[model samples]
Target: MDHDLALIVGLVLIILSIPSIIAAFSDGHAPRVAAFTIIAGGALLVWAISSKPGGYTISDVPDTFVRVVARYLP
Candidate 1:
């Protein structure tokens, strides 16, 4: 996958895991999926950052998003 797409997907996975993590604490139960998501997301994010030519930063996200979207648009 492209660096931008990988980074975006990783961010989304991390964001999604937040809700699962919160529920685990509030409900006194933990889901294995939450743990997996955290690990996978972090790894993917790190890989994407390292794979990028200049190492992605938060500031690069918007431009990355636009560029990727433009590529897929008809």
Candidate 2:
């Protein structure tokens, strides 16, 4: 996938895992799925950043998310 798409997916996965992690903690269970999700998300983020020239910055994330969403949506 392109850098923008990868970035968005990685961020989304990480964001989504937060709730699962919280729920697991509240239930006193292991956050195995959440941990895996975080790992996958981190891997995607690393790949996207390393593959892209000049890399990305905090200021660029909003634009990247908008660009990826617009490209996929009708």
Candidate 3:
């Protein structure tokens, strides 16, 4: 997968898992799925960072997302 795509998916997965994790904890249940999602997201993030010549910075993230979205959608 493209590094940009990996980055986006990883971020989305991690973000989406937050509510699941919170709900699981509130219910006194193990956050098994959310934990897995986080792990997968982390792995993808690592891969994207390592594969890219220069790793992403906080400021570059929004631009990267916009570029990727524009590329894929248009």
Candidate 4:
């Protein structure tokens, strides 16, 4: 994957995890779900960092946008 894409993905994951982390702290019933979200988000971020290919390319593709949308809607 392109480095730019990877960075975008990682940013997306970190962004997604923010709400989950907040929910985990504010709600009782959502802790488990929140925890899972946080873990999954972290994993995705790590994967993006480790999987990025050589020199990054700049693009306007929607991978991160889609991932963020999916995280909120799913």
Evaluated with lDDT, which candidate comes out highest?
2
Residue 20 CA error for candidate 2 (Å)? 0.3
What TM-score, computed on C-alpha atoms, does each candidate reach? 0.84, 0.98, 0.95, 0.44
Per-residue lDDT over 4-56 for candidate 3, one digit per residue giving the tens place of the 0 to 100 score: 88999999999999999999999999999999999999999999999999998
Estimate every model's Cα lDDT from 0 to 1: 0.87, 0.97, 0.95, 0.60
For residues 3-50, could you state the per-residue lDDT of candidate 4 as single tens digits?
445556656666776777777777655567656765666665567655
Q: What's the residue-level lDDT of 55 in candidate 4?
A: 29
TM-score of 1: 0.84
The residue pairs that clash in candidate 1, if any, are: none
RMSD of 3: 0.8
By lDDT, the candidates rank as 2, 3, 1, 4
Sorted on TM-score, best first, the list reads: 2, 3, 1, 4
Model 2 residue 48 CA deviation (Å) reads 0.4
State how far residue 73 of model 1 sits from its true place (Å).
5.3
Clashing pairs in 4: none
Candidate 4: misplaced stretches above 4 Å?
A: 1-10, 27-30, 54-74
* Model 3, residue 30: C-alpha shift (Å): 0.1
Q: Tens-digit lDDT track for model 1 on 18-62? A: 999999989988668898998898988899999888897778898
